[model samples]
Target chain A: MKLLSTCSLRKVRGRNLLIVPDPCSGNPDRILEVTDSFAWLVGHFKEDVFTVKTLAIALSERYGLDDDTAAKEAANVIQIWQDYHLIEP
Target chain B: MAGLSPDRALTLLFPLLRLSLWGTPLPDAVKQETRLLNESDWEVLISVAKNQSVTGLLFQAVDSLPEDIEIPDKTLVQLAVMADRIEASYRRISTASEIVLTELRNEGLNPVVMKGLSCASWYPRPELRQSGDIDIYLPKLPTKSGRHFQTSPDGSLHFQQDGVDIDIHSRYFDIHHHTEYLPSVPSPEAEWMMISLHILKHATTSGVGLRQICDAALLWKILPDNSKASLPIIFKATHTMRWHLLLFSFLEDYFHIQNPLRHISSKPLLSIIAHGGNFGHHSTSRSRLLKAPSFIRKADTAFRFLLRIPFSLRFAPREILPTIKELTTGNLQHAFTADSHSILH
Candidate 1:
């Protein structure tokens, strides 16, 4: 079985950090407390296609937020994180 | 299939129950009964059948009849009594094995028995050590020599009496590359060294816990100083402590067994550190190491290293990593199936 990259995007002290280096760089970025939901989304999906439905479920569980609000907020935050290059498509 | 006789079934069931309680899964009834058994009762049965051949009446007392399919109350009581006897036997065998190992050394045969026997002789208490088979290490040619060795036609070691199983190994790590690190040393010296390395590697890398390393250190302390000369052979056989250390580091970073390094008594940990190759400081806690993210990296590195070993000397890396993962993750059904396909051929 192939070993998959586990690096993910995180927020350390309010600054968005990429915990893992891009594969091309061979050095990982250091971020703090980037919840598994964020990591899973970033690791498995392209940022451009990261949907509100997926973000909602992930955020609801990740931050203990109620469903509809979490969905709305996660979609917005994911777009912002993407715009900031905290995650790559 | 040959169905077990009632008496034989009881004999099998008692230990199976204990093993299940130890960690293996078992039927609800058996689990319930096992929970009712006190630690002392558990100790008793383990002690009796550990290393002796008991026949006739004592056997009958512990044995149940095939006609009675279920485990009878009388049989259970007998089992409790037998547990004490078995535990005593475990101790006696451990002591005797220590003596026998010394004799084997005198005969110029390097011998190291693994698992429970090692635990009984090396661990704090016989009961704490549980093993179903005897794993012995036999030193052959080094991996660098480009030679492969197998057990003799008669087998490396095999003898059976009553119903107990006895197995002997001339090698460890069914894959050839891993076995290559084993080098022939002068008898008991080799045994002691192998056991120490096994404990160290398992504790540090596999995250199996600190108890094993503690046991190894205890054994090292108790063994006569005359065996000290053999310590170098372990390094030579395994090609320095780097491989084991790296292996442990990788495992710790990935699998997250435990950091006995932190929990273990200072004295033994100090002893290991003083020896100085591969044993070093690790900053991460056990929990971080167990998560999938860390494990993937660690496993990847370990897998890469195994791949770099000379192919001729190596077993299929493709097979080893998955098997190790399955085994470590407690997927025994899959692990056994994978093991049969990879090793049996």
Candidate 2:
């Protein structure tokens, strides 16, 4: 999954947020709070797409965690981001 | 008065900002004071930075302090977050500016971008500078009449475009009605003169802010030696040589730039900036004057004008009467006049 072209990650008022511009003029821009780890994960995929397996591998390398543990964590974070419509498959 | 005898925040913030904007070596006294800042002091410093529209610059300074310097992790995080948000906003404004500029060019108008984006280009990371409305100078457009004829007397036409405000100016400088001293449009000489006069205009009226002064300082630092030598003569032609010296000297002291200009009385101007924050939004009487009854508002405005008289007289005496005339006549004529005929959206 990759971040939507129109969406971006920004830290708003001290909170990490996934900013998605609203399509409707009457609606406000969507701001979804993201965890620090999730923001770090997003940084790695800024120029490319990533799947749970790739994220897990990257996370394992960065944090020196076992592959199984990293994969579960990556899948959980990615699921939340997908639900928020920040990620496009 | 408040800025003259600055409180704790200004004391620490001044040196930190100098370190941030230029790589000026921090004084021992300043470093010690910074180390002693409590959490509350940090909050005040952050507030001042935000109010002055220099959060990203302050963040860089704070982040680059020596290893032994003990800024709380939470403070660092706050500054970082705010800086990120400012940069994000700058990106939006930059894209919007490009769209507006392209559309103006498509319409056969030669729009020379002034202030906002132009100043940002001098910074190491242009995206980190605080962005505002785009000010474009259209030399071809006549001040008296144009496609956008609803412009203010000062030759500015404002409209919303590409989700950002665009101010089209038919004239380069707002200091004087006459352009006898100014050279041809689109030249570097005229641009620098315009920037200096813009700062003087604000300083003599509502009040100048640190951001504009920082812009002038950064722009001055990059100018060639010959260009620097030529500026005094241009300012002299416009009868603003005194103001030019005062401003550059102040910048030299504040930003600690190399080759200091001859010292002058910059305290008054510094006080104005410290009190005004960004565009006088943080002036002591601003909120009170805004929410007061009509009579009280008038009184407050008069009082503020009186306070500004001495500074105006010292810096740019030619502007005092014009400012007074503006105050009395009121400038309610030019608000978002090009809405129906916006150049772009």
Worst 10 residues of 1 chain A by lDDT: A1-10
Q: What tier of docking accuracy does candidate 1 attain?
A: incorrect
Kindly report which residue stretches of model 2 are placed more than 4 angstroms away from their true locations once superposed.
Answer: A2-40, A46-49, A56-89, B1-6, B142-153, B258-261, B279-306, B325-345
Model 2, A24: alpha-carbon shift in Å? 12
Cα error of candidate 2 at position B316, Å: 1.1
Which candidate's TM-score is highest? 2
For model 2 the local lDDT of residue B122 reads 86
Give the RMSD in angstroms, all C-alphas superposed, for model 2.
5.9
The TM-score of chain B in candidate 2 is: 0.83
Evaluated at residue A26, the lDDT of candidate 2 is 20
Tens-place lDDT per residue, model 2, B1-345, is 122123567656668777777777689988787777766677878887777777778887886677667877567656766666667668877888888787778777778999878899988667778876678888675333223323443546665554566677766786754468776676777778878888887676556667777788888888877877777777778788788878877877777665335777777777877785655443333224334454554455567667778877887788788777765554333232332233323
Best by DockQ: 2
Error of 2 at B166 (Å): 1.1
Q: What are the C-alpha RMSDs, in order, of all predicted structures? A: 25.7, 5.9
